[model samples]
Target: MAGKETKKGRKTGLDEAAIRGLAEEAVFARGRAYRDEGAVSDVVRRGDTVTARVEGSETYRVTVRIDAGEVDDYACTCPYEWGGACKHVVATLLTLIEAPEEAQERPSLAVVIGSLDRDALARLLLRRAEIDPGLAGWIEAECAAAPGSDADPAPVAAQARAVLAGRYAERDYWDDYRPAGDPAELRDLVDKAVPRLEAGDGRGALGILEAVAEVFVEDWIETSGGYDDETLYPLFQDLGRMMAEAALMSDLDEDERASLADTMTDWDAALAEYGVEDSFALAVRALEIGWDPPALQAILNGEGGKDSGTWPPKGEADWTEGELTAVRLRVLDAAGRHDAYLHLARAAQAHAAAALMLVRLGRIEEAVAYARKAFGHPDDALALARALAEAGRAEESLAVAEAGLSFEPNESVSLRGAHSVVPLARWLREAATESGRADLALTAARAAFAGSLARADFEAARAVAGKTWTSVRRDLLKTLRAAERAPERTEILLDEGLVDEAVKDVGGAPGYAVPEAVLLRLMEAAQSSHSDWVIRVARSRADAIMDAGAAGDYAQAAEWLRRAALAHESAGLIDEWSATIEALIERHRRKYKLRPLLEALRF
Candidate 1:
């Protein structure tokens, strides 16, 4: 219960000792200072809810809802936002040793459908499909498969469908605040969107439906337990119908209309295998173009590609000697091979790249360790400082930053960390709020603002002021003081498709206006910079953006690359600018199915 009452659960096979051990281990291992105050303060049970308030320096509360001996939903007001699983959650789960007798006594799906024959199971599938078409194929598959001596396919298929539906239902709880892409929630959205489209609300339907046709290939990377292409034909057939209608009847702007057209094109091809000719035709015409599916598939499948030896060139190394060394060190550090990467990275003189990779691998301590060793390299030192800060070793991170300032008292140390402080503050704020220490969150927020201010530009840095971020902690506290009521904002700027505005807003924060913000305030600062600078900076940011996109950070990556492209243009580097812009256009096409640049210029 983050600002509300804690729910309790019926006590059954609850193990206080086990939960306590797990809780203590999680807190102590994580180096959390709060767990030392006390033990589990209160263990209350109410129906299916189990809530515990652990007393440390402050009260740390947790709510756990158990379903069939498994932890279903968990929430904590702590700074541990990644994956939404904190010590409190682990503690609560530890506390739940088993389900209550009543829970176990309840009739499971197996009990109801266990006795059903093949035909009976198929009939049940028909019933479930009436509610959700995704279940139809699953049921059919179960019916077709030969039954084992003890096997019951009907209940098995039904259980699979239930699990899928449940994932969709619980998606709202999975926050985007985590670092890894929320693939589970996205797939859940797809499951829900398919059903929602049946009601004919295209905009609302599309809102939930991200244009992830590229990801569709990735989704099939691993074989799943659900229906295959053969059995799932009807589902695709339905989807093709939806796409056809969406393309023809869509009132979206040119870019969005093109995107819908793109969907139509993809579904038209997809539906061809299902023999849905009518649906396929509508989808094909909606895009105002047509392509032979077999020909296109052949090319994409790599049959018409250039020579294997000439294209990509195997074993020559994808990067330069220096870049490869850097990548190796990063890999070593990430793999917890700290000693190896550290030694090799230094021997190879790739400290900067190694340090950056170490940070990416979450080896904060190891990164700092390498940085200390590579103090001879300024770039490596900077990367180490960033890694430390990113990993929440803030005090050490700050020390590195300050030391860099002492030797070469420049804007690099300060401005280098401007972007990283957002998440750190978020974590700090979360921890502080959970421990009844608003002052801590506020302190982190002020430090974040100060870091932003150090950027040598003001207006540009405040543009990324996310409401959940620690930089906005003061604003939250200030709102409380002024009695200014604002709805609690949970979603990120990009989540609402306002990433461009967010960049501007974060740069405009009172004490956060850094030099970069001011310098970039001009219309074409990106292109106006020196040619060498444009090439280097655009390529750097472009690479980072692309990495982020590959990891599903679409909105954030798109905005960063856009700025990079503009910079290239200002430097009179038309080819570089156009190439970067084209990449961004492709990203938009794949993500929202809209070409952002073409839409803006109408070219």
Candidate 2:
């Protein structure tokens, strides 16, 4: 998940709110970090698709479909299993969003390919094939396989074998995690099945999944393809999910379903040997129960299916249930089984998805009612509240948002919490203030400050605190004092003009160099009121650098010395300041960088 790391870039041209809506709050925030840190590079825009490599644990290739200047579809070659855009995709999108200029414009693949003549194209293909040993055979196999044909796993199986043999032969090194070449090449083959999704060609997809999985598992067993580090986890996770979705979308007969389920069970057993268990549980469930569980159908038909305890022959509280329910919702919605989708989402506690669906269905009041009781996660309330606000239901939105303040999860309580706590609380405060609900606004303001210790948040809380700023400031200061972020703590106090507080706790330490800008401003602000503290802190800071022979920081030491001199002069200690400067020159005459800086500090 993400936390703030000094938003030092332009606001993204892409819809920040819409992007946030797409990802979990934590993931969105972490993407912000990746973008800020310049992790996204090799950015190239080819018409609607933006491609980049986001450098993290490993360099991941990411592509996002940009339609109407907004994200339409995205994929990342990273092992992130959590729902929503993975950090790599998020980072790439953010690069396109915030720093659009960094993305070089290029012609789309269609344009380039269309412009090429047959001979040129053949030459290009031959050139690439010569470089990549697997490309020649893979292309031959692909060309031989006809589209719209029955399931033919042989071509794909051969392609996998060719790609892997090349990868293994070309491997430069081996380790527990660093597998031969890249699993992403195999994942690229998995992505090949995605197009089959358009026709709901579950049969075609099955052929591809079966072929790829066979090669992947066999490679692990035969060689030291070491899947032990979960280097291959993302590929298998995506494979199983795709298989589940295919089964759900397929109109398989009872026998076909049973066979598919057995395939998943076998794969699960094989993977368990390498510390991966329940590898195909979701796929197995999808194949075994093709939406005809008597209990599930009964509930969907409104025939008393409220047995939450036995929804999945009794509910399972892990991530699998959520994933399974998600697939069910997708299939049911596609089939226009709106009523069934609603019932299943509620049973699975997928309140956020259900509430959003209800809002779309224009059952606004029902959506609000469901969300009021659906405090499953911040998103549960967030989805409905955002919907209501967009619909001009100001009062209802405030009510939902207020209830959400109490539902903050432990994971998101940190200032960097993905709880959407900061933004959600800010929205509530501003809207409540506009609606003349000052008390509500004030409470929301407090929540915002607690969630994000930004100076802006602090000022927003101060604005809404009315006559309670006295007590409110005390509580906020407590929060700041206890926070792990020392720089933020100092910035907030300094910004509030609490020089004494900033000086005592933040800058009092001998070697603790508060940011140079903050230290410089602190001396300027407290020269008259807290000159002694400034002199001690500033002199100590400059002395630390000079004493440590920090050649690169001599300029900063000189600046700190100048500020300390001003503070000393303000306290009528100019003579003392001169003595201190002269002694500093003699003590480190050997330090060439320090000599001139010290001599320049003298009157």
Candidate 3:
């Protein structure tokens, strides 16, 4: 299938093996199912690129760019962050390979847009905006005002301030301040200021940004009672971009530039009041407006110098001397001062940075050694693994990941570990399979599943286990059954349709000590074939809950009793159901708080 040309004269670089190699076994299987089930549609091929929509739980746009006999790039709009091509992309590729005739002839977006007249385009935008207010706001911000309109800046500033004020008005202390605002109003305000900056109204744009920044900082302080990196980082990034664009205006005189710089400096002062030292806006503005290195360094080092009590500001303040140094390093790197960056990073024991620099300088051996040393720090494990894998040392990459996997706390099993280790395990599995070590591949797949289980990532675990499940089912079941968390083991059993084993593990005499939620699930699972067992388990659970002797406890007991009664009724055991309810009421009759609730349950 290598270099096979389709009727469109584009070579199909992807075959079954290549596509399978690109995706996880489960992802590939799911993608194949999707293709067979006709989930991929609206496929269009242009030159070497194929675009299609893959319908899953959500419709995702998949694009695959194939060049010659190799898959160049694969992307999908779905939020599948498993560190590889998502199922949608796989599905699209499969459709392209199996059903080339289904490739629909779609007009290029440029052609379609060019065909529409101004009025038609406006109408189309209006219709789209009616559906998506965020889109409307963006369009309004971008097109509503001309670059050098006679309109006063005050009104625009007020409009932008009003947008922020309205957004923050109802917020309270417990609310999380999200960077993603109400219908992109914050972005709209920023976008509106862009045209002013483009028109050489640097001062005006700076004013709007300053006002918005003030509101953002104030609201953030009020709602969270502290600064947060997640919110502030993005806000400052936007501000920096605006500052960069405004600083580029050729028509702006020195006075206007100074005014813009002053506006940014004021923002830095405002952040200082809250003990924040990391103001990217001030740093970028200083850099843009040609401030000397020492002055720029002072802005990053906090206004009071390094000896100040607030030099290393604590808690939610993203700016620190170390961060400043990193930024400086980045600037140095960007300015082609690689030697300086490498020296600084090495001196600071910023091994990750040093390794990255070495890699950039094509010093592969030095980069690998630095990466290995960096992996001694647990935080650098993922980066080291990625670096090694990228350098074609797949075995070493897997080894680095395996070493780090044991470092994760074993207090609970969830998919958190899967994110870091699953990719490595997959790489190892693929390599082992290719090297004719199916046993080693199976072992790697098991390790991946174990990591997934630790992370509570059952879907990923299931996916990893899919290929070898039939052969290893008994061993896996034995291992799960012997696990520490009964609920987790029982869940796996139930998910695998091992109902009898799940029933045996979770269903027993009174006083089963698993969590109430797990107990209820076991009872539900047994309700079909083991109705009597469900009734007994539910009664035992209700008794335990009622034994707490609190008002809340009695309410919970009522819920469990209701479940038992339903199970009895479903099994046509009316007498048993009636008896169970009567017994429940008798047991809780003395608790006057629960009397009203019990009376309502009278059959």
Candidate 4:
């Protein structure tokens, strides 16, 4: 009944009746009655899983998880369940009843592209292949196989272009597609085709750009954001503005570029028509070359409005000297103007963007100089600390990181500062041991452990140990010289198989004299494994010791088998433990020279 449709306008899915019935049962069991005012809130479908939220008049959100013909899980944020269904399920089911079409297949590329016709297909294929030649073959194949299509015009066009561009790699195929066309004409066609991707036609756009990129330098590919521009199609109108702004930086001559400059002016005006404020200067710089920044800044900062007497004044201050100087200093540093960069870096203290840019440009000493004075700004100090760390100046990195952390305890700077403690601790421990200061090494190790826990979590301590485990072990051994009794320290010794010292130093717990059988069993369990090889080897050794009349060995063997039983119990493998115990008892019998006390066992 839940699968049945009730109204023509109501969407389709499993029956609302069935959903309500299940929810009703859960609600009834919880002693809650549904109100008539309860309403469905939302229905969301992800893959085969559908979640419905039902809200009461009080605006509570309850969610139901349904999967192919069954209600898999239910949860409600409301306080209705002592662990039971709440009104959320009811709201979801109610939502499903009103809009069944929303439950249909999700929107995907195939659904979108399937709507295009033959002429559209041709245009899209030609456009895509011209942008990215790598896509030419693939687009051609898709076009040819496109459910009842004809006329393979794309490949013929591609071959002709290849020959005309003098990039005809397949020399023998050149004769087959000799262009009756001009090379300039083909280049223009390809250029036009490439922009289709910048429009809403993604497949076509990718093809065009790929083809252009394959024929150009690596700069085109990297600067293009690797063809990810196609995803920004929904913002094409904005994208065009950005493209135009970038074009302003081009090195084109005055006569040749006049038309484009006028077009950009018109675009800017239209942007104002839509009440949009144009503030993206970077795009303008990227697109156009030889643009006078001072002039542009004057227009941008509102000093040269539509009624201004001077059209972007020739000589006077176009941009604040400080802003212009800061940006140039940063740019010079970027372009390897090291001395000039350092001189300007100190002057850019209040400009965080310029400070960061300086750091990125490799002016580390200058960046640090500013960092010392600008301790009031966290970003400056953080950047300086990062620069020091990247340059392998561990001590300086630690100091700067600490200063940043001290400024704000919970900031990312604190986390970065905390990370430096481990290495610093290791270095101190090393220095102490080299000079024979065993006490100092031990003190440093303890200090490191404490500081690590304070600075970060246990994982950070583990990371520090991983980086300096060998040094840590050396430092830890130094503690043994102090004649201190430390079980925790002994555990590390025993674990490292320093057995002779363990025998001399750790004498109390029966945990010390554990037989190899017990040890092997624990090791197997420690590794989460039940190895027949290890088990048989353990049993063989136990049998040999039992035949030798060692009751201690037999007891130890039995103990190991018992621990193995516990491991099996936890794994829900009780039957395996029964067999293990039988073998253990038999081994003990031979060792003690007596029949086993227990005859048979069942899991």
What is the C-alpha local distance difference test score of each model? Answer: 0.42, 0.74, 0.61, 0.43
Q: Give the per-residue lDDT of model 1 (tens digit) for 248-362.
A: 3334566776666676566555544435443334443433432223432233233533432121123433222223233333334434656454445444445555566667767
Best by TM-score: 2
> Which candidate order results from sorting by lDDT in descending order?
2, 3, 4, 1
lDDT of 4 by residue, 421-460 (tens): 4444544455445555555555545555444423222222
TM-score computed on alpha carbons, candidate 2: 0.61
Span of ten consecutive residues with least summed lDDT in model 2: 1-10
For model 3, the stretches where C-alpha displacement exceeds 4 angstroms are 1-114, 117-159, 166-183, 187-211, 218-319, 333-336, 360-362, 377-379, 387-489, 496-521, 528-533, 536-566, 569-573, 578-603
Output the number of the lDDT-best candidate. Answer: 2
Is 3 or 4 the stronger prediction by lDDT?
A: 3
**lDDT for model 3, on a 0 to 1 scale?**
0.61
Root-mean-square deviation per candidate = 25.4, 9.4, 13.3, 25.5
Q: In model 4, how large is the Cα lDDT of residue 474?
A: 57
Model 1: ten consecutive residues of lowest lDDT: 485-494
lDDT of 2 by residue, 1-603 (tens): 222111333233475666776776447767877888899999987777778999998888988886765678887867576789987887777666666678777889999999999999999999999898778767755653335766577777788776666455533344333344565667777777776765667777777787777776676555544435455677778888888887888878999899878877887887888777776788887887677777777767756634632345553445565577688777778677898888777666667777888888989898888887766456556667888888888888889988987876533211112455777788888989998999999998988888887788888989988899999999999998887764567778888778788777554565254655566676798888888777887778788878888775676678788888898888899899989988889999999867987898898
